[model samples]
Target: MQQQMIDLEGPYRLLYCSSKGDKDGVIQEIEKGVSPNLADYDKRTALHLASCEGCTEVVDLLLEQGADVNSIDRWGRTPLSDARIFGHEEICKILEGRGGTDPVGLDSQSPCYEIDHTEVEMDGATLIGEGAYGEVYLVKWRGTEVAAKTIRSSIASNFRVKATFMKELALWQRLRHPNIVQFLGVLKHSERLIFLTEYLRNGSLYDILKKKGRFDPPTTVAYALDIARGMNYLHEHKPHAIIHRDLTPRNVLQDEAGHLKVTDFGLSKIAQEKGAYGYKMTGGTGSFRYMAPEVYRREAYGKSVDVFSFALIVHEMFQGGPSNKAEPPEEVADRRAYEDSRPSLSSFIYPEDFKT
Candidate 1:
């Protein structure tokens, strides 16, 4: 019986079975008292391989057998991060629902980009930006420069804050595009969680749009196309689609090369995962100014909502700062967005082809 091969062939069998998503092979191994978290040379567990290959059935089996969803491998990567980077949206939801830990690394198929916090030099660190959730700092790591997004030690202890941070980190790990910010890896500094990415010094599109006012049609279209391409990639991502519920100038970044890359997946969602069509999740997300009508109304929304928010962004690209200027005041913007009326551009000057 396969059960008799535990000592002689357990490691190879478990690794091979997990890699192949063979539920039966894994079950027999586990039934013979093999630990689900058993690792090979790299310390990668069965759950880790299942997560990376998006073996939903096998993942379910391993988890049912008490596999450690949050188990960290030798590289400090977790199964949750593995599911994320390969566009395994269903696996991501499963792992998240199972309370996966967030000690992260790049997907198994990609080159490991995780940086050791001990190797980082903090003397030259500079605070480049801040947000409600965390702050972005420029720091040196292993002789290379990187942007470290740090969560305060006090704030990191909050369960809600940690959940949100984990969600963003997971989603960000999956995205890889020239028009999307690249996620290097993550680090834990005592009580704080720090995620690192390639540092782009040009700042965000919000900064440039705020400074330069409205852009000409040609320039606006160029920026709009970059966002569109990135959004399209997310929308058509394999296994499931991703909706950037908050697609605005603020979430879009500009590199030193004058290229636009979409950032901020904190408010993003996975559409059509887990066998649910137009998957309905909690509502009332995204910025009121750029929010879709259905989203503002708390109605069941699909990926099209991103297009609605993207339209507002495209409008802002040509009309200057925000599309909400002509709407009701900030205090009543949500109500106005959902009730008073839909925002619109009275007129637009662009190429004839762009009208379509």
Candidate 2:
């Protein structure tokens, strides 16, 4: 009876072997009467582990031995889900071709869960940037380069954070503009929420400006025009007007061809009423350096807020510093000042004025 129970442990051992990519160990374990359907602590079966590891051989062997492909883990994640989340294109294709089940439909429950860190594989991907809420990686998808934004599991669990993520996805799906970063798709895993979009190799305009001191006249004008065009499209072309509450150089990415793309819509809002730009009282929505005077004051404003930020960016492009430069006290005071009494757009004095 003890031997019988040991033989029954075949499936669990097979799962371990498959996860480790040890084909010989898997065969040996199976010969000892181990079941191939045994699950781990997370209820993930051997097939799930195999798919996640991108071990095509292990997956094929298990499938040939009559392993159920439709089985889901505790979180209702099938092997197909693992393949997609790990970006295992070939394995995913094979599973799909073999009539694998759709993991997305297993549970109508919110697709938020904890993932084992060891299972995630970041292949052909490079981490390029990070922020308070998440990190951004560059990946190649189907021969095209893309930017994959991943929010950590802990952050995704917060209601506000999750809402912000969903809202960004909604905005991206409906937005159609050349100057905006093209929305590719989203990947939800037990460990992270990943967003894939066009990858801009040149990084943000802020980095370039900070490194190079300032942009030339034509370059500055061109960048400004691209931002304006993207904002105009977002505010006017959508079913509901969209307002990009956070517009900063860091959110503006540049491609190899020098085309600018607006990105990071996490703080964006949809405008419902005519002439209403959907300004929120939330104080921490935007970056300090690029934030408009009205944004800091928590006053009701409209699309003009964006225009104000744009003007500041133009100043930064030419002045080699942020709008608040050379006036620390005034900058602090301006934060509490009313929106109507804030300094005019001319506050961004051009650098050429003192070039003599």
Candidate 3:
């Protein structure tokens, strides 16, 4: 029975070793008569894992052992597609040489060009916004204006950064909602990875709150409803719930039509259904001022974390901005989590219904 079990598990062992870049273990599995093309539950073959990981040696070994280079995973991604998405240039060259093709089709237009034949100067000139690992540029694509989100070239060569970008890109591409910012397509650049989206001229909710201080009750209600609808769509996603871990005004944008749309999903978490509280999540995610108490405490949390953040945003809508501006944002978050600190709702400022 033990021998039977080992034989049954040989394919998984091959996949594991391949993902870990364990060339020798892969060789052992092959010698034990396991096919190099053995796939996982996701239909991801050894070649697919090796390519995505940038494990060139393991990739080569698998190829030599007759692995199918064009094998498509459950997501319709081939080994070459994973390699390209992760910025593994050398591995990409090897895979392309082996006739590997991108089964997962991405928009092929280059959206980083400028009008009037002038070179795009990325030196803070065309820069519109900045994120933790990327910069957003206002660029021209086929005579239309779009926001190009680019990973900084300095770190674009790093595999981990590319992997994270790809993960976010994959998730964003599938989302369809009026309250969510539309993902236009991807642009392949030699220096960095670029993805495009519809550029919102009105800017973010943060900009609006900064300028107006606070909104009237009717306006606040409209804005809050927009955010709630978007959050509802995300949390109700099929297969898994997506928590916008960073649900703050800064990450929400206002469209030309004056409706709010959710953007910047960099810190979002796709919650896998487990128990009541959802999956174990990474702590310290998102801006401190809007972070949920459970997240600040690093405890297991669920979709309600976004609800907590939504409440803070609604508070800001009524109060003009984040409270306790005198102290650092981190201190404020710490107090909220540990001391149960909350912003005061003045009786004069809020309507009796709102106060209740």
Instruction: Estimate the TM-score for candidate 3.
Output: 0.64
Ranking by lDDT: 3, 1, 2
| Residue 53 local lDDT, model 1 | 71
Q: Which candidate should be chosen as best, given lDDT against the real structure?
A: 3
Candidate 2 C-alpha lDDT tens digits along 97-169: 8888666642322233322333334565688998546888877655566677887787687889688777667
Compared with the true structure, what per-residue lDDT tens digits does model 3 show for residues 1-356? 23423443556678768867899999999998998888754477889878876789999999998999899864466888767765689999999999988855452112222122233333443788886558888987665567878867765687986677667767776654557886766654445576777788899998999998988887787788779877887887656778888898988898876778998776777876722475555555578888888888888888888888898898899989888978898899999999999889898888888767
TM-score leader: 3
Residue ranges of candidate 1 with Cα displaced over 4 Å:
1-114, 122-124, 152-155, 159-164, 274-284, 326-336, 348-356
CA shift of 138, model 1, Å:
1.5
TM-score against native, each model: 0.63, 0.58, 0.64
Off by over 4 Å in 2: 1-124, 159-164, 277-279, 325-356
